[model samples]
Target: MQQDIRDKFKNYKEENVELSKNHSIKFEALLQQELHQNKPKKNYIKWLSVAASVMLLVSIGIQFYPNKTSEPIITKNDNDTTTKQITLGNISPEFNTIETYYTNSINLEISQLDLSDENKELVDSYLLKIAELTKEYKNLTQELNTKGVNDATIDALIRNLQLRLQLLQRLKKQLNEFKNLNTKQNELQII
Candidate 1:
């Protein structure tokens, strides 16, 4: 029985089968038909996407475009031959009042300082500090013009003014103390 099973296994042979030429041609035709059927759908989707993108870009451009009628009129000063600049004072009545008040207060504090020969260096140092603060204030004003009124910038502008006034007041007080000290030293020397 074992010899019979071995003989049957040795006699078995695998068959090599392949698709006929006619079936191969039919398969290729079916594949081309499927691709042709889907081509229009793919092109339609591509054109639809491009059209949507163009509409989106046009809407964004429209939103960013400045309106000519609402634009501010900028008139050059004839006498100075310089362009007039805008500031927070021009933005609103409330801001104008606040700006005017701070400016006047800062000027008053500056004018009250005793800028004698002895105190010239001290005064100059304070002036330099004030000038730096003024530059920062100008930057804040430009920011306000570009970004419009916001709490952070408004507070910064006001704080800059306050700091300038405080610096001037402190300088004045120090100068007065220096004068008193000098007067006392002169009296002691004479005695």
Candidate 2:
């Protein structure tokens, strides 16, 4: 009975060894197939890198290429002289106001007469402009007040507007003085 048990154990060991060998062969074949499939992917990545490098080099070359020729458009016209050349003080209100004030004052003193139609017209024009500006400023202030303006900013804007209004009033007074001076001169001339 003991001899039969030893033979049975030996047969079991031989079968286990054969089964292990077959499993090892199958695993090695699976590994080989996986490696073969990955080999082409490595080559594809290498080719992709080369292609990208070539495209980058071509783009850089195009950017550095210089333009061979270019020209500006030109036209000639005989009537171009009709346009007036505007100097610095040509349309400056500050300068114009000062010039007009001085000229008008001199003319008034020389002429020595009551307000003429032209003089009244000039004064009225300036006053109307001032009144318009004043009304605009008032409306702006009212809107700002309704919108809850900052106190400090409101004060600053008000101060600036007052200064502008003062300047306008000063201009008006200067013009009136010119007219009065003309009237006085005319009275003196009569006397």
Candidate 3:
């Protein structure tokens, strides 16, 4: 199929060559006229001046009519020496607030639960471990912030929290199971 197409193209080229030879004089004159017209004119300086003026006007227009900001231009000073305002870019406040609320809720829930002294001591130790872990997490987070870590650290921290949360859930489940067992044993003794 390709060879057939190539043969057809070769025939077309031969035909075109023959046609071109017959009209070569007329073609040459037309080509010369086109080339003369296409060549840079004596008015090149005038056209260049016009183009430069247009570019200058466009530059001036850009300086004046820049794309309008969606947000207000919060300026530090009247001079164009101001910075762009990025909205709510920092997450420290939101993170801190949420963490505080979550930790407080956990503490409150733990305090409201009744348990034996032994179990209470165990829970206290677990809480202390969590506190230590949280402190270390905070220190690491601060270090990452100082070193300009990417959002990967945030993702890692979230994953760690998820793991910790799973562990805590398991601990709570076990604690509940232990409490139920203890209650049943006490009832059996009473019986």
Stretches of candidate 3 off by over 4 Å are 1-89, 92-105
Per-residue lDDT tens digits for candidate 2, residues 86-135, read 21122234434443454345345434433467477765665576566556
Expressed as tens digits, the lDDT of each residue in 38-143 for candidate 1 is 4444577889999999999999998777544332535568887765455656555566677778888889988888878998999999999999999999999778
Candidate 3 lDDT over 1-191, as tens digits, reads 34677677766744343465659799889999988886556898999999999999999998767333323334455476664432212344454444455555556655555566858776676667767767766765665555565677666555445444555655677788889898899999999
1 or 3, greater by lDDT: 1
Q: Which ranges in model 1 have alpha carbons more than 4 Å from their true place?
A: 1-86
Q: Tell me each candidate's TM-score.
A: 0.54, 0.28, 0.42
Per-residue error for 165 in candidate 3, Å, reads 3.3
Clash pairs (backbone) in predicted model 1: none
Candidates, ranked, lDDT: 1, 3, 2
Q: Report the backbone clash tally of model 2.
A: 0
lDDT per model vs. reference: 0.82, 0.55, 0.62
In the order shown, the candidates' Cα RMSDs to the true structure are 15.7, 24.9, 14.1
Indicate the worst ten consecutive residues by lDDT in candidate 3: 83-92
Q: Point to the candidate with the largest lDDT.
A: 1
Q: What's the distance in Å from true for residue 40, model 3?
A: 62
